[model samples]
Target: MRHRLLALAAGTALLATTACGGQDSPSQEDGELTPLTAGVIPIVDVAPVHLGVEQGIFEAHGIDLTLESSSGGAAIVPGVVSGEFDLGFSNMVSLIIAREQGLPLTTLTNGVTSTGEQGADLGGVFVSGDSDIESAADLESARVAINTLSNIGDTTVRQSVRVAGGDPTGIEFVELPFPDMPAALETGQVDAVWAVEPFGTVIRQAGGREIASNFVDTDPDLSVAAYFTSEQRLAEDPELFASLTAALEESLAYAQDHPDAVREVMTSYTEIDQSVVDALILPRFPSEIDRDSVQTLADLMLEDGVIDAEADLDGLYR
Candidate 1:
């Protein structure tokens, strides 16, 4: 996944003028709503965006918003870069790697964040109840399933092992979708799984034991993901960007204040069980991105060989 993203950035130069620079919509006239599309992962992390659309927040801003689901950042990044999506939702690690490799991208608003609580975070590394792997340290040289390789999952999982006095270099990372992790762990397809809610909640209810809170171990206030757009999109319509940013901020704040609403919104977009939703450990959705936590992720990425150069953060945010 790391190398594939780098290759996308390497080839972006040729597509910049036609793809990134192409206008997806005409200029908005007075009292006209600009239509916008965003590629997002249909996970609990994005409940706020769904709730925002349901509450007519984007409509109030004179924008017609559509949320499209994809597997992960691999699809969302390219969709935004090629103007197929006006905006995208992705983790900090993927965005950092994209920026470092010369993809013209910038964050528009905070998406989701860690709970900053060790055993109570929204995501964690889990194992079967009777597995001999009792802690993060036992993960050395063990196969662990994650949604993406060389991204936030393995990076934070490695950090958890390191913090537990284990050598993280020997760990083996396997890529698997978040929804499939619980089944894989139950069947012993992997030693453990790094999962996020409400899948994490599912695993917990199925007698899976969380050995480590990967996000919390990486950074107490880790800015896990954000809603972003290509620099070209931002430059093309600053007014639309401003209105969408305001709408997103309101959505994030609303989700933070209304936990029950967030839970209710998840069922509309995701196939997660209602029971799991009730037991979910929700992540924080702040209106502002945590730059310090983002930098921490970038540093870890560099150390982990995920990127060859330091990411330029100066113009990475709107």
Candidate 2:
């Protein structure tokens, strides 16, 4: 069954912006503060970075952060490659695969994590309430929706299904943005969707339920999202890299200590209702990237043939 799985030579492009909400357009000119443009998704995992911007944490470090929202890891990776973004926030799985493909992305800080905390639904695989799919094994020969292919969404779903004795390769992935997932499930456009928060909360509100928890729990705690930049940036400007890292670490501490402030900042960026924010289980915000956790993801990709060769995990962090 493992051998039959579709090699994630899958599409890496991001989903388009949704109808209801999005980030402000990137501004080119700024007078006093240095401009830092980043590619990101408007999910709970990224709230800390934005929270930092709101509290002027980045500005204190001599940077004014602007955002470009991408719907998938594919979009963010390219944004970095094309010099459209100074840094990107995405999952370890995508970063690992991109590095193996020679993208030269380096991890800077930790983003999000899931260790099956009681009420925190960081992310999951879901089917509508009326659907017959009951387990990962039932997903064989079924259609699954993801915001991005060959990234976190693909890797975790495959790992969960394979553990449940299903043929993960037999499942077909249909690309759908996080916002579109609920409608697609209701109209029967797809069998199930793997979504990150607060969309997982959205799915449940729309009468959907998850079949698995900690789908991304490949290690003791899965590194679901991260902040990364090109190798060239690190080589060219060590001061900028160090400043960004230090500033973000402070932001993470502030976010962790003040949930209300994080929620307030999140509402400004994401389209999610305030009610969802009230109920949202904010992801674990760590100060530094865990090398071992990242190594686990790289090893998984090599084992699954998502990457052609072993990635130098140790070198991922500069």
Candidate 3:
């Protein structure tokens, strides 16, 4: 589930030891662009940022970023919380759950959302061709694979299953990385796999078929992932914040304008073959946060017990 995923870490064991030191804005040392490290997952949702880095988008803004892959908030959150990573690419549900569990985070920019085209291949629950599952309702008492649990992966599935007239409470969620899902589905390790973007397209090519489209099934226009930082960093370095945001947005626009180029750049971040890359169905790159969609997600989380309280969405984003 990536854009639909979550990796939340709690307790002192996962806490970051260091937080970023305070700074006013982007720093320059003898005219060198400021360098910052970022935490990310190599999924389609994060392609814009990677494309920006690959094609000098960030460099053009007088900044350079080092992107490190992390599955979900479990690793990404601690890095940001401890000041180890300047920014993190992750899903909204993962961030919200982390915040609910005591992580202080801030939204940088909206990442990917549904393309608003029904069944256009954004994200879905898939099963191998010979599998008996034919609909979301068939998923009851089945083993489902998700990149991470208790975040977008499980949340969206529950919503879709309910919509399909099934009791999701009987569904068993298993954590399987996206790269392993196709094989898992093929080998019968999982009855259905929830996947997004290029991975979804990859699975379908490998004899996998859709059981339900989570993005569209849950909400036609859903806010999936975003680039974010800890609240500590935002307060510590407002200037760097502004600069990074401008550069990231510029790169996002480039991604939207040049889909083919965006896919080419994506191959560098993911292990999918160039052949697969050439035919992927790209998720829409949203320019700004959608408060209504976020609010709707929060309401669902609250209903599902993923969050104990309503998240202050306006305070978390611009």
Candidate 4:
């Protein structure tokens, strides 16, 4: 029983932008409701912010939150830097690369994290059930599919292979949309895929077997993604960011405490099937960023030649 899953394409290409948007200070009009736009990807990872808006958490903090869905961090990073969004959601790798590329940005809060269970994490490298590839090390000469080439997906996958004593250099990474990967794997177009829920769930239900939990292999408490804003935006209104952070923290706690709420909110923003939603392995949403895990990721990135220089960890957070 193959189910068609819909997910915002995670393919990314960071573009340089010089345009600016948003107010110098949060609007004091309409009973002091500040209109803020956030660039986000419409995947399972962003359900907390959606739930926050629905639960009036942002409203309680004097914010009229507007979420603008984009492809992935590739779009969000430039959008946030250009002030097109007051804040944006993205994978940690994108932010680190952006920082190294001279884009001034800082994390507002942690977005999503790994479950820390080897094969039971939210996302993994999966292959067909009947395949001989029983572990990550077998992927040495296999063609793996990842949404983005030089970003987190391939980087963590390579780490998983290396950790499994495989020569990752021979692994060919194919760039495909998340929505297309399941089908590609089913038809043997690629040997494996780095899939995240609810696509991971879909693949499992369709007889795919998870070989490696890349996120967990990278770091047990791997801070996969975060909500971030440009330094200019944070400097423009420190008080506003404080309130926003408070609201976001509250939202994160709420989502963590209420898994049902997170699953419910996912349907509102995406066309994910209800059955798959119920079976989703949701990622952790901690309010505090895992700085050590982030540093580990950065170190791995540097070692893998993903970044030219070491990322400045101090200035990368709020």
Q: What's the count of clashing pairs in each model shown?
A: 0, 2, 4, 0
Q: Which ten residues in a row have the lowest lDDT in candidate 4?
A: 1-10
TM-score of 3: 0.91
Q: Report how far off residue 265 is in candidate 2 (Å).
A: 1.5
Taking all chains together, each candidate's TM-score versus the true structure is: 0.94, 0.86, 0.91, 0.91
Writing each residue's lDDT as its tens digit, candidate 2 over 115-176 gives 45533458888899999999888888889998876666777788778877887888898878
Report the Cα lDDT for candidate 3: 0.79
Q: Rank the candidates by lDDT, best first.
A: 1, 4, 3, 2
Tell me the tens digit of each residue's lDDT in model 1 across 56-144: 99888887888999999876887788778888999998888788767888999999999999989989999999999999999998999
Q: Candidate 4, clashing residue pairs?
A: none
**Per-candidate local distance difference test:** 0.87, 0.74, 0.79, 0.85
For model 1 the local lDDT of residue 267 reads 88
| Worst-scoring 10-residue span by lDDT in model 1 | 18-27
* Alpha-carbon shift of residue 156 in model 4 (angstroms): 0.7
Can you write out model 3's per-residue Cα lDDT over 195-264, one digit (the tens) per residue? 8867888887897888888777767778888888877677666787888999888878888888988888
**Model 1, runs deviating above 4 Å:** 8-30
Off by over 4 Å in 4: 1-30
Better of 3 and 4 by lDDT: 4
